[model samples]
Target: MKFKSLLAKPFAAYIYSKIQKEMMHAVADQEAILQNQIKTGCKTVFGRGHRLDDVHTYEEYKQAVPLRDYEQLKPYIEKIKQGKHNILWKGQPLYFAKTSGTTSGIKYIPISKDSVNNHIDTARNALLCYMAETGKHDFADGKMIFLSGSPTLERIGGIPTGRLSGIVNHHVPRYLRTNQLPSIETNCIEDWETKLDQIVAETIGQNMTLISGIPPWVQMYFDRLQAKGGKKIRELFPDFSVLVHGGVNFEPYRPSLMDSIGGAVDTIETYPASEGFIAFQDSREHEGLLLNTNSGIFFEFVPAEEVFDENPTRLSLKEVKTGVNYALILSSNAGLWAYNIGDTVKFVSTEPYRLVVTGRVKHFISAFGEHVIAEEVEQSLMSVAGAEGLRVTEFTVAPRIQVAEGLPHHEWFVEFEEAPQDLSSFSLQVDRQLRKRNIYYDDLLRGNILAPLKLRVVRKNGFIDYMKSVGKLGGQNKVPRLSNDRLIAEELMRFLQ
Candidate 1:
């Protein structure tokens, strides 16, 4: 083992033990966080406006502060942007994480001094937990590359602002700096294709051990490497052992990624957002991510079905039940209160609060009154593809409500790395699996209200081309799995094979 790996092993063990202890006392830690947030809120302008001073319990907090999305909270954020102090949190935010929004053009999410530590620490602990559990710390001996946005910042209201990943890039520890790949100048390139080429040139010959990024982008990198060197990634970088992925479901992309690597590696899934780092995969044996309850955030879950109601049922960590789908809501030290982050999740284990991200609240197909979520489609397609030993590059689903002669149906745009022998039969199996998982879809098909989903084969690099056209090619952007309308479907039709 390298000297760095030997030094990190004991530290990883200590951090893992601390994390295990925190998981054991998750409920108590959550309660303490909630109380602390409430106390801090009393001194903010938002708290005064919402009558937070009189709120003594969870029920009172709920009644005093209504759930708010980005649009609803924009007014207060605007004041903060104008250099107001104690508007949201105790003082001005340390940074604004700028992200593209669907309805709203651009969103500036605040990261306060108290909340930023959670983002950095949670990520470190996740890797440390893996090292402690598996005794595999040799990856630290070689280079580690996190494919992220540029570590560039501009001032907004005198506060540093940039992408969340970019902001975090500035805080990477001194020890890891020498081991990090793709020099700062290369990362600063705005265009993804240009940056991608630069990254390939810089790291292709290096001893890359750990690779991290969203799966699709990482897949793109792998393709570039293979094209350049004419060798599998495993052959090019024999020490490559761990892949850290987030932002989307990994199952659909796993077959293709594994094929490119030519072997197996430890993969870790993380639940991170501009608001906070919510969860991370803690064990290789576990099925779900271990919730970050001891962090500077308090979590709540509203039943998915009732999310649009005037007042939805909000359940705390102690009250959530396994297998029920719920929309994630959070109140954090960042001064976001009862904020709905638009993600739907299901608890797989309530004992230690392990949950799986189901889908986004707005990213679903309900055009035909049959609410089809991302989870159902991902599971159905992956199940069928895995059974057939086929490889899928990427895919998305959108409703097709108009037809010339027959009933309308869901249209699946699939890009295949290895096409199945019988495409029609594969589509049928996928539809069957989805029907079994979702009774509403089955009922719609039985009632003749909708036709079976049709698969449209897409040309290679179709999704990538579409994203590039829209100027959202990389850095935390992902193709939505499903949509209620045909906006994306119409645009995607141009790429059909």
Candidate 2:
């Protein structure tokens, strides 16, 4: 492949035309941003102003800057609230993408022109790579369908700042852009119901091809599409090329989604955040997604083992190798310098820098000191389901310590698409699998630890509906994979009880 790429370099250049130059320019621009951040970041820290010495290299960038979260920058954010550009940017931010405030309620993530440009470039690179591989720029001469969030623009006083989706949606090139299906860009409004109505109306008789969004939301969208009286959307739009999803793991909702789609529609995983579109699926056949290093940021990784309880062990772009788990860190033009985004990934390959996301370091349960990761839990559940031939609808795991004057145990509340005949055995199987994978669970089995695994079956789709009713639909609003305290667990227990 390397030899072919080298030999085909001249021809590739001829074929790509200015694309190669644009890619190179993108890299140069990203590097310049990193350089400038290292300098300004120091000035921002000291309030003494920045100099050349303060900037340069990862070490200097680290030393000259103090780590800050969104809360720390609240004063500047307040300025934006008052319609002023105070700290982060030279002017008022283009607009804010309304993201769920994980621990803080609802907060708006400020989006700048540079950050938006980076996201655009990432999308272009992904599209170009696909075009180069397939040799067919257009898929079956049909349009793509993106099941996205409310694309209504944020107008403080009705001036049209543009919807988060529309910001990029409107910028799609006139040449490549299609007129086939409804886009979230123009369709997103205040009401989700009205948006869904328009989406259904627009794609009812059209040749819609691609579908993209968070998995659970996509499943709900498919349900709506099917509910609109279609046996198969394939029958409606035969050319549908693929389903693209990201923001959260799709494993939990895969069964229902796959069943709704009838089969796999060439699934593509994307790792995009308000920070930037960081990585994406390289091809149809590959398991590992390609990292976009040449996008608007310089990538760094901290060994996953170092991600919890201590300061992280950082790695440069040149130091990352295969098979090791690392927490992702980024230094981008959008004022995030060496920012730890809390996502953990495993290196699948090094040459082109491909990785498989393992789980979030913070998103785990250690109630019985089992230290169960989200990936491990997902894999174990899938394995158990495959073994039992059971179809699951929705499920959630809560760390519980059964203290009834007895030893404590971890409990999982599951909702299956079909109820099993031997519920006890199925529950036992899930418990045993956890015991095998988690040392703490094993200790509990041996009467060493205080807790063992327990399972409770719930009505179908109960958990999902509850999450939705609470407005925890997508984009940072998720039923947590693990909840240490009983806050979420207690709330969920309302329906279970």
Candidate 3:
């Protein structure tokens, strides 16, 4: 009865149509966005050194700015941390978005005012797209349970720092904040477990119309809710209509999450990162997420095969074709210039440039040159899990490289809600699926170069225990699904022992 969408719906439809039209000319938009960014930042040190002072066109900008990763930009980032002005972008960053880093430790990504505002606006557009697509407006009348990070922003090198979700929470629209769950006091609870406990206590009886979070944490909340009510979630909250999810691929978690819901609910996936808001679900029936082309981020792609080459071909939006796996690189208003986000994706469409996240640049197994990606492994496991009626709680895979006695094989540490009756068959099915999916894996198996995939059933909540032990309990932290070496495997197994 509280249909507020009479006006909002038309506006959403118009905005979505406008966005679609703009995206058709995505390459042109990307070009202009980058040019403007260069001009605005030309006086900055990064811009000056990268020859942005003279670069006028996309081609010229590309030629001048060599593709670089986080390490190469660290020195400049350090200068910024010391309160330097105009280091990467104009003015000091409003804050730094801290994420996991390799080599030198935590990565501090600069979040300028422009970048933050764009993130806020892009997020709003995502909702508008959803409203235009679904026409489910009743949810707006009730509460929304958003299972994101604690909102207790802390300082990192003089600038406010926090997880992406925490930063986003601070900007939740005034109208929506009225229905948002987890009181501000409860949100500030540092421990994830304690925060969830408090959140459950606060909203267990409320009319939850929407739920949003990463699958694992959201799954935890659902489990606790079901435990409290001893009833199906649908019965507990009949008004719940949508589940917004992202931060990891939803395929592996979809079946289990659907089972938990006990009824139908619309789902929308987003590809928001600490560095930028990239893409979101716009089409109700589409397979891949629609790219946020006109958002304050310029994107480039390098073919996966040529990712490590001395001089890889960097393709603009217009040059990218459907189905080719490419390493996604971003030049954003956040001061990330042609920076690799370590994600690989494949375009599923060209006109509006919709794409699916394929895998991570670093989180893949290839010790034997089988070169298996997270997507392949996940797809294979999900297939087997589906056929055998399995619900995976968590899993991680690693190459069991050269033990004193055993042959080289991939090891899986899996935790499931419903344990398979025959673990051996489950393991065999996973191996067969992998071979079927990846030609290189099939070839390796055929040649007997690699032994069969090994599956080890971890104790219930073993991954939770492990993540906690490693000080990575919550807030956008997920264990890498596939590791190239036995280092993680050994450490994780040792932790179990």
Q: Which candidate leads the pack in lDDT?
A: 1
| Tens digit of per-residue lDDT, candidate 3, span 1-497 | 56555657777889889987887788888888988788887889988887788888778877988788889889999998887899998998988887887555888888999899777887677778888877766777789877878777888667898877888889998877888998999888889888888888888899998898888888888888888888777888988888988889988888778888897688888888888988888888878988888878999999987888989999888899999999999998878888988899999998778999998888888888888998898999989998877888888999887767756789998888878999898899999999998999888888978889988888777888888878888778888888887665776775441
The C-alpha RMSD of each candidate to the native structure, in angstroms, is 0.9, 5.2, 1.6
Clashing pairs in 2: 153-163, 408-451
lDDT tens string, model 2, 387-461? 877777666677666566666766677777787788778777777777677776687669756545667777666
TM-score of each: 0.99, 0.84, 0.96
Judging by lDDT, tell me the better candidate of 1 and 3.
Answer: 1
Pairwise lDDT winner, candidates 2 and 3 = 3
Model 3 bad stretches (over 4 Å): 3-7, 494-497
Worst 10 residues of 1 by lDDT: 414-423
Question: Judged by TM-score relative to the true structure, which candidate is superior, 1 or 2?
Answer: 1
lDDT of each: 0.92, 0.64, 0.85
lDDT pick, better of 1 and 2: 1
Error of 1 at 457 (Å): 0.7
CA displacement after TM-score superposition, residue 469 of candidate 2 (Å): 2.2
